[model samples]
Target: MAIDPKELRRCLGHFTTGVTVITCQGEDGTPHGATVNAFTAVSLEPPLVLVSLDRRSRLCGLLEARAFTVNVLESAQKDLALHFAGRPNQEVRWAADSACGAPRLDGTLAHISCTPWQAYDGGDHVLYVGEVQQFHIHEGRPLLFHSGQFHHLGGDHNPLLWDDSADGPDAGVSFISTLAGTRRV
Candidate 1:
């Protein structure tokens, strides 16, 4: 009747997720953050997002007090991810989000600023649903986390593959031309 924690973690590791570092500033004016993989787009209608944090983490208190920013790291930013996730002995620098005052890492692929919408108790972790007030996208492939490691996407050694089932060559060309607006020479 009981489930094994190791097995549960191993099973969940099979599901790949984009890595992000969620950050906020504490009341004492200190920045706090943690490497998080439990973030996702909740809804488009209201522009919502969700990030789960362990109740005991220092970042949880900051998130409870003020707004937060989710900095989605690109594949090139794997060091940033690992740095934030590393031991407390390592020093990390964080810049404040100009719009919301939350802490954010520089040169992220994308940043989403949000106000806390609602919080629900999820066992040891609390799920904080946020209403995205502002966001910005940049050009880069996302850093993927799976099987207890960070994976780089879309490189010479690891190229992106389109799902063939989605369309044929003609459809692909049309889609690219429509998106790009023209062909070069």
Candidate 2:
């Protein structure tokens, strides 16, 4: 049976995600950005991240593989997100260079500077993987998207710590086991 696109979309909407603005210098030498939620860290060792963009998006055309920045939006920047997502709002407030010379927005949670590493075909979307060059992080809660609406994070944090020799959860250690037994520093 053929799957309906709307049904697929609704199913995928169950996953909560962080909002981001993928910014890059346009061919005209001006900064251009697109609001996207399809952004995630691809690797940690080489510092890689991936952003998926619609093939027909104007921002996709404006984007150059190398030299782009991912601005993780804060909850306060919902207007900015809507602006870049095709609803022009009031003037954007861009922050000056702190980590790299990429155009960044004020009130963002973090800025990730990247150079293109690879691109892959993703049907209607193109997955662009980038090597993180530099980054700046501000202390704040990130803007979140879920079920076609915005959400905020609840105050819950993991208090677990692992030793250097520990291999994380796959190392056969459970959270309850750690609390019940002596933990390695």
Candidate 3:
């Protein structure tokens, strides 16, 4: 069967993922980044992560040469995500990650410093697997992406399904159902 690119993209959109702005400083000493959702935790023993980037991205070469930082934005940071994802002509401001010299946004839920470990050619994109050298997690709900939009994670107003009915015996079932149907975003 012939695969339609548009259809493929739309189908992939169904899988919700957290949003992150992958940042790095170029050889020219300029900060560069792009909004990315293709991120995942690869290992926990030594701490590792994987982020895929389109080969044609301006930051690709810089990311290959130097260390990089992944700033996981909080729900309130939707503007930052949109900024980094903006056109190349737009301006962006970034600060340095002290441990690795990677660029990081001012405020984020978490910041991870990593050294490029492996780069594999993956069709139109390059898979960048990194070894995490250091990381910091702050208290805040994460910014999520689903169906091509940003979403806030938490609030007192949103009650847990199981907690909703104290007298209900189907709490466990309700919890599982909620988990299965709820997208991260």
Candidate 4:
């Protein structure tokens, strides 16, 4: 039996995700974007990321084998997200120049530019994987989404698990070592 679409969406909504605007240049060389939450870091070896866009979205067609920027939104950029999601905010800002051939949005938490790596059919969505070309990060908390609402990071314990350190659970060996001490193996 087919699952109810609303039920599926409600179940998926439990998974919190970072908000982003996937931007690409149109055929006319103008910037176009869509607010996307289905973004993932696919690989680190070649530095790949993936964004799933609905097959009907114009941004999906514009991204065919082209460069794009995944601008992770800051906590304060909910209006920008709404704008790209089709609400039309006239005062939306743009960066001075393009990054990796795609227009960059201003005041984002992070900007990751990429060239098209591959595309795959994802039912009603198309998963576009991109090879990392350039990226920038600013010191700020990310915008988040969950359960059909915009959210933000909370004061959780030890939220920053990894950092610029040479140590601290960096490998499987360290995890095994920690477990070995508590087990009689």
Candidate 5:
């Protein structure tokens, strides 16, 4: 089916995601980063993570068999995000270069360092898998994005929402329907 790109983007944007800056060194040994939200934890046994980059992105070209860092942005780091996303900011805070030789931004919520694990063609994008080497989590609220805008947490964290709910994903569809007072026809 021929899908409208705009419509597809809109639909996809409904899903909220955390913002991150994928950092790596250029061929000249200079630090570089790209603002990306297309990142996820892929596995546990071998500690893998994934980031999808546009095929045309300079960072995509630089990631082949390279080491990189994923800097998870906190709510106050929107300007940093904008900077890596191609909008120049007056200043960016750079942490000490990571073990992987990639620069990390200071004041981020988390930093995940990785070495190139695998790569796959993802149509307009390239899926890059990284074998996690090190990770650090800091205390801060994550920067979130949805529907073309940035968002903050509502400060409502219900730890029991899933653990104590019969309608949770672990309960199966029937339990969800029952909890909602609905039934299949």
Candidate 6:
């Protein structure tokens, strides 16, 4: 016999994911969005991303062979995430992306504008892959969700805090040291 669906869902919930609001316009150009945590980067060379949408969602139908924007939510914008998830909150901010004409929500940590590339059947969800047209990564921590709860970054170590790291910018392996000024590795 097949495993219990609830058990499978609980197992999947162990995988942490960043929150996103995938936005696209209707035939009449009306903006529409839905909170989607099932999103991931598919490729880097051509810059592609994939987002899974429920088969019955309205936005899912509109995205067929259409352009869209994926707004990776910041931790402070959790209410906006709830709004897109069908709980309509008080504050909703959106602006049109100049490159793709897709709606990108403000206060998001990052945004990716894309053109429809391909679609795959995913049992109960449609996996839509898009070719990235433009993207922006602003300064903010991304909103995260895991085990049905909202979460924030847990690590204290930031990789880019130093102006010059040995393996990063400096040639001949040089680094900016706090004690001695410049150290060569």
Residue pairs with backbone atoms closer than 3 Å in model 4 (clashes): none
Q: For candidate 3, lDDT tens digit of each residue in 149-178?
A: 787765664543443443366545433225
Candidate 3, position 87, lDDT: 42
Candidate 4, residues 1-185: lDDT per residue as tens digits?
Answer: 99999999999999999999999989998999999999999998799999999999999999999899999999999989999999997686889655578888999999999999999999999999999999999998989999999988766723423322333455333211232242211
Q: What residue runs in model 4 are displaced by over 4 Å at the alpha carbon?
A: 155-160, 163-185
Model 6 lDDT, residue 11, Cα: 92
lDDT of each: 0.80, 0.82, 0.80, 0.88, 0.88, 0.87
Off-target runs (Cα >4 Å) in candidate 5 are: 156-185
Determine which window of 10 residues in candidate 6 has minimal summed lDDT: 157-166
lDDT of 5: 0.88
TM-score of each prediction: 0.79, 0.84, 0.79, 0.86, 0.85, 0.83
Q: In model 4, state the lDDT of residue 13.
A: 97
Runs in model 3 lying further than 4 Å from the true structure: 87-93, 154-185
Better of 3 and 5 by lDDT: 5
lDDT of prediction 2? 0.82
Which candidate ranks first by TM-score, i.e. highest? 4
Please give the RMSD to the true structure for each candidate, in Å: 6.0, 3.6, 6.9, 4.5, 5.2, 5.2
Better of 5 and 6 by TM-score: 5
What is candidate 2's lDDT per residue for 21-117, written digit by digit as tens?
9888777667889999999888888999999999999877766465778999997888889999999987988777435455777778998988879
Worst 10 residues of 1 by lDDT: 175-184
Q: In model 3, how large is the Cα lDDT of residue 80? A: 81
